[model samples]
Each structure stands twice: as C-alpha cells, then as structure tokens.
Target chain A: MNVLRAIYNFIFELGDTALLFLKALYWSFRPPYRWRELFKQMEKFGVSSVSVVFITSLFTGMVLALETYTGLKKFNAESVIGSIVAVSMFRELGPVLTALVVTGRAGSAMAAELGTMRVTEQIDAMYTMAVDPIHYLVVPRLITGVTMLPVLTVISDLLGVIGGYFVSIVLLKINSHTYIRQMLNHTDLHDLYSGLVKAAVFGLLISLICCYKGLSTKGGAEGVGRSTTQAVVISSVVVLVADYFLTAFMF
Target chain B: MVEETVIQVINLYKSFGKQQVLKGVSFSVKKGELFYIIGKSGEGKSVLLKHIVGLITPDKGKVLIEGMDIHQATGVDALKLRRKIGMVFQYGALFDSMTVYENIAFPLREHFSLSEKEIAEIVKEKLALVELEGIERKMPSELSGGMRKRVALARALALNPGILLYDEPTTGLDPLLTEEIDNLIKDTRDKTGVTSVVVSHDIWSVIKFADRVAYLANGRIEFIGTPEEMLETDNQMLKRFICARLEDKLMTSLFNACRSRGSCTS
Candidate 1:
C-alpha cells in the first residue's frame, strides 16, 4: 500500500510538474523577461559542462571501440568498426552518456542552488518582486537544457567517433577507408534524428527533475543535500527508462 | 496622529501535521508602524510572518493585507499583492551565485520596464541606502553577516514595497551589529514609510525600535501593547521572554528550534 501510494504521488507530482513546465514556457516568451539571466544559465549549463562531457565522451568512445573490435574481429567484421561506433554513438551512447554526466555535474548543482534559495527564501524573494520564480529560475534552465543538450550530444558523438577512429586505425590496424565506408553505409539521417530528439528529451527531464526537487526542498542545509541527491538519482533513472521506451518505439 | 491598518490578521491558524504552530493568532500593523513580534523563539513568529506574505497558507482564518484576503487570492492577484510587501529573511537569503548588485537589482529587473541605466540608478540608490555602495561586486559569501543583512534589506526595498516583513532580523548578530541593524530598520522605516513587521527575540530591538510589541506564546498572541506597556506587563511569559534569563532563553530557543526542525524533518 505504501509503495502504491508512493507511485500515485509520483504520478501526481509529475503531472503538476508538466503543468509548471508549460507555464514556464508560456512565461519564456512573455515580456519583462530576463535575457541576461537566460544567457548566464546557458553559460553555466552549457559552457561550464563542456570539460566533463568532453572527457567522458572521449573515454566512452575509446572503450566502445576497444570492446567492439575485440568481439567483431572474431566474426571477421573488423572492417565495420567505424559504422558500429558511429551508429551506436549517434543512436544511444551520445545522448545517454551526456545526460548521465550532466545529471551528475549540472543537475546536482542546480538542485543545490535552488534548494538553498528555497530554504533561505530567495525564491520567495523573487515572487515578492512580482517575478515568478518559475520564470526567473526554472524557465531559463529549461531553455538552456532543451537547447544545449542536443548540441552537446552532437559534440560528444563527434569526439567519441574520433576516439573510436584513433583506436581502430592506430591500435587495431583497420584501414581508415573501410572503417569510414562502413560507418557511412550503416548510419542514416534517421539514427541522428532519433538521437537528437532523445537528447532534447533528456535535457528537459534533467532540468525538470532538478528544478522540481530544488523547489520542493524544505529544512536547511541537510534538506538541500537531500534534494541534490534526489535530483541526480531521479534524473538518471528517468533518462535510462525514457531511453529504453524511446529506443523500442523508434526501432 | 491618525493610523491606517496596513495588515490585519483575523483568527489565523496554521499547523504542520498534528503539531500546531499558530492557533488563532491575530494581530494588526498600522500604516508606517514599526511592529515587532517578540517571543521566546518558537512561538510561531516566523510562521506568522510567512502567513502574512502568503508563503504559507493558514489552516483556518484570514490574512488581509491592505484589504485583499491573501489565502484566497488568485495567483495573479497574489502576485500583485506580494509586490506591495517585502521580506528580509534571518539569514539574509542573498543569492550566493549573484553579486550584491545583481541580488539587489533582481526585483527591479523582474518587475519594471526600466532601462539598464535606470535600473543601475535604482540599484545605486538602494546600495547607498544600505551604505553598501562600493561592494556591489562582492558575493554573499564574501560579505559579513551584518553586510549580508544590509544587502538583503536593499533587495527587499528594490521594489519600494509599502510593507516590509523582517524575520528575526538580528538572530545571529553580535551586540553591536544587532544595534546597527536596529538603527538601519528605523532609518529604513523613516525614509520609506514602509510598514515594518519585525519578528525577533532581541529584547533590545523590541525596546528601542518597536512602536508596538506583540508577544507570541502558546501559538497565540499572549500580549500586544506598546514597548513600555510590554515591559510593564505582569504576564510571566512576557516578563521572562523580555528579561532574557539564560534558562528561559534556552528553553524557548530549544522549544522553537525543536518545533521548526521537527516539522521540517517530518
């Protein structure tokens, strides 16, 4: 019964959150907007997150290449390494890995930031100023996340492919031409399009979970910590679950 | 001198689960009045202020600000009504990431259609009012406790709010800083004509700054009178709360802290 109640409350919360996002979107285009805040959030969410994303993507690509080459060589399919890496990176790994990294880096920080504000009444202060907290804090983050995640995924995919290329050509002695040809042959616009869509969704999910958890935080420092942890956990789980359904439906 | 009632609370009741923090709490603040909610610490002073600002809704009863029923007000109306009230939190509640200038300028930027130059001018004026003109570039963490409160005050005044609600404005300050804050509050009230409702246990503040003092006890207003009247009251709770004896202070602090912390934990 407790589990059932939890699930019920979760669904209700999710519905309310979706409504909030819609309201945030409505306010995004409304006047008295804070363009400066939006730009600042973009920089914080997108620009500062690049180093971690880049490092994680590079290593993920290299590892995928190594693992795939080891198994594919047994089937005499080593020539298809680039195609496998490119397709997998575009279709699944790029968006998923970038999102997971961001959930740790940006999502936790966002939760902590807003959670502190919530407890300390800075968010309330915003409301008292005739400014909606959703419009000021959540909307800019939503916009940044929705717009930047796909771009970040594309960058991650490119870097991952480069890492895979290096591993294939340098370590595996696979011809670059064959690798490139196979990659181009197997992957299509549909694969890239699906990945970008997933990236956007993942971005929205991360921002929503983080912002919701932050705003709901009560108590003081301990509450902020709990919200941060919950934001990361919930976002990561949601990203993985959504990825499964999206992939199943798309395929 | 004639006085207008800026805030009138009628039978306000608020509870967290089974623990009732405020039970039929009622009070009023006259226009431009320096009012203080004096209690032994957890007598629902902060909770009462939160209700006034519509941060928390009362379980029963009404909170009328100027004339609008806040708990029943629509979101649009509530937002409009909130614009007339400003709050300074105990911890200053400054945005950690933003500089002092950005924090103070937040309300102006959010509410008005002012140009950058106009906003800058207002920001400068507020900073100057708080005597923090040159430290606009400093973050909240860099500022001392007293400075943070001043910045918070400047932010609260950014919209030129008619009503100012301060929650424990001198909680963690040293003696000198507490007096400094008291003076600042008086100065702000004088200059802005903002109806000030201060929630604090600082007896000196109650004695010096408050035109009227309301002592909260047992989730209700135990006493409401002028500072002189409050000091002269024979009510044991009011007397003990005002005397600041170590045992009375500890018990009050512990009770209030436990109540707020307990509610938060649950």
Candidate 2:
C-alpha cells in the first residue's frame, strides 16, 4: 500500500509539473509581457551568478587538467590534456556543473521566496486581483531560466577552458601554443552549442520545479524550508540525470 | 434600491487529504452587505472565502459571483468575474518586493493599460482613502502591522471591486488596531457600498459591524443570522463559541482597565 501510494504521488507530481510547464509556456506567449520582471530575474539568476560560476568552472577545469595529465603521462600522451579538458568542459562539465551551482543558489532562492509568498498569501492575493500567478510569477522566471542558463554556461565554458590552458602551460610545463592548438583542434562550436542546449533544458527544469514547489507550499515557515531544500535536491538530481541523456543524444 | 445577491456558495464541500475542511457549507451575501463568517482557526472560513473568490475549486458545489457560476466559467470569464472581487489576506499579503505605491498600483497596471501618471494618481487616491499618505516608497516590511493591513486594503480597493473579502483582518492586531481595522472595514462598506465578506473569529467586531453573521463549526455553518439574533440564539454550540469569545474580550478589557488604574494583579 505504501509503495502504491509512492507511485501515485510520483505520477501526480509528474503530471503537475507537466501541467505547470504547459501553463507557463502558454502564458509566455500571451500578452502583458512583464519585461521588467524578466530583466530582473535574468540579472538575478544569470548576471549575479557570474563570479561563482567562474570560480567553480575554473577550478573544475584546472582539476580536470591535473587529473588527466597524470593519467595520460603513462602513455606519453600528456599533450592531449588541454584537448580532454576543453572537450569535457564544453560537452559535459560546464553546463552540468553550472546548473548544479545555480540549483543551489538561484533555484533555492526562488523556491524560498515564492514559498514565503505562498505562505504569506501573496500568491493568493494575485489570484484575487485577476492576475494569473503562472503568468505573473512563473513566466518571468521560466524565461529567465531558459535564456540565462545558456549565457552562464557560455561563461563557464570559456572560463573552464582558460583555467585548463593556464594549468596545462604554467603548472604542467606544456607549451602555451601547443595547449591552445590542441584545445582548438579537438573542440568544435557544436560542442559548445550542445552544452548550452543542455543548460537551457536544465534551467527550465530547475525553475519549474522550484517554482512549483514554492507555489504549492503548505504549512508555513517550515514548509518554505522544506520546499527550498526539495527544489535544490530534486533539480540537482534532475540536472545530472538529464546531463547523461543530453550528452549521449548530442555527441 | 432592490437588494441583490452578489456572492453565493451552494453546498460547498472541500477536503485536503483525509481532513474535510468544508462540508455542505452554504451561504449568500447581498450586495452592499457587511457579512461576516466567524469560526475558530482551521474551521475553513478562509477556505470558503477562497471558493467565493474562485481561488479554490470545491469538490461539489457552485460559487456564483455576480450571477456567474465561477467554477464553471472559462478562462476569460473566470478572470472577468475575479476582477470584480478584491481580497485582503490575514497578514496583509502585500508584495514584499514592491514599494507601497507599486503594491497598490499592481492590479491597476495588470488589468488596465494606464500611463504611470494615471496609475500614480490612483495609487495616491487609494492611499488617501486608507488614510495613509506620503509613504509610497517604503517596502511592506517597513510598515507597522496596522499600516500593512491598511495598505493591503488600499490595494484591494484599487480596481474598485464590487465585492471585498477580508481574511482574519484583525488577527495579530492589538485591541485598538483591531477596532481601527473593524471601523475601516465598516467605513469601506459604507462609502463604496461594496459587498464585504470577512472571515474572522472576532465576535465583538461582528456584533458591532456585521449586517449578517455565519457561525462555522464542525465543518458546516451552524448558524446564520443577524448579530442580534446570534446574541439571542438558542443554539448551544454557537452560544458557547460566542460566549467564549465575549468572555475573553471582557476579561481583556477588564484587565486593561485595572492595569490602567494601577490596582490589578494577574
């Protein structure tokens, strides 16, 4: 019986998420564009997050270079470290890791803010005012997430490659020209595009899940806390799981 | 003027999980009436208000607002019906991110195409209506409790909605502030002639200002009548509820009086 209930709940949540996504999409095309809200959300989720994404991606690239150099040196292939790091960052690490960081940062913040609004009856106030909460709240965030994650992922990819180049040349004693050439030859614009597509998908999932959690929050402050945590946890897991399929489909 | 029923709930039923909140609840509010639904916490008074506002769909019932069955209405129809009603939530529910001016101007901006100057004029008018002036730039968090509720009231009245819903409007307020809100609600109804539906446990407020009162208990409305009728009721459950609240109010008043005289000990 408990297992049955679990399955039912999972299906219910899946249907709910799908419905919310469709509603958000419908409202995004509708009039009353809410440009102010969209720009605010873009700044919040994308531009404000540049420093954290930069640091994380840079270190991730540096660490990847370090790890790959030791392994490739066994086969006299240490020269390929830059290529491996660049390809990994472009196709996999950049989008997935940036999304993970954002899920923790902006996603949780979205959930918490909306959850507070839910608990405080601000969302209900919107409903009473003849404003659809989906149009007013979710659409802006959804647009931001879908648009900004790619921009952040681009930054991440660039920073990651730069970090990898620095490590390859300065730390690993590889020539800077060799490192740059190898990275350029091995990675393509398609790799960057694929990562960006993945980022957009991840962004959609994160914003939708977080906003849904927020809007549906019950109980009160404790409920807000629960929703925020669930938004981060579920979106993080979804990002990683989606990354695998995206990588396979794209590459 | 001929009386008209502006809001009606018929045999409303709602359940969350295993707990049923509203069971066969039915009531009607006449146009320009100050109707109050009084019950203890968790008795689903707010739930019923939500139904009337088209915020919640009942499992089995009809909520008609201005003669349109709200639940059965389509997208545009629902929005059109909802626009005629304004709701002030318990904690004010002002948008925390926006300034007080922006909060009052939000519904106006959303439902109409108005220049910022026009919106500002309306916002100023609403602020003046609420007797709050010249604090438009402050966030909701900056306002006192009474100020927040008044701002919420201004926002609710911005579109000049035909019906107004107040959910526990005096819940956290002190006695003086509670009276102030109660009087504000009465003044709003008096001045605008808008139908008012208030969900609260404030027996004194209902006794003083309500044109009609409904007592909700045991997942249903146990009594519905004028406050005089409620005061003279033979229904034991409702009498107990009213007496209990009255007794509390009396004690608080007595305590305050004694404290003022410097002759009381708890």
Task: Report the number of the highest-TM-score candidate.
Answer: 2
Q: Kindly list the per-residue Cα lDDT of model 2 for residues B17-79, writing each as its tens digit.
A: 999999999988899999999998889898888888888899998988878999999789889
Candidate-wise lDDT, in order:
0.87, 0.89
Q: Across residues A103-138, which tens digit of lDDT does each residue of candidate 1 receive?
A: 898899899999999998888777767677887889
* TM per prediction: 0.90, 0.94
Q: DockQ (C-alpha) of model 2?
A: 0.82
Worst 10 residues of 2 chain B by lDDT: B257-266
Off by over 4 Å in 1: A1-16, B244-266
Those runs of model 2 whose alpha carbons end farther than 4 Å from true positions after fitting are: B245-266
lDDT of 2 at A62: 93
Report the lDDT tens digits of candidate 2 across residue range A1-251.
99999999989998999999999999899998999989999998986678899999999999999999889989988888888998899888999999999998899999999999999999999998999999999999998999999999999998988898888888889988777788789988888888889999999999999999999899999999998999899999999998888778776
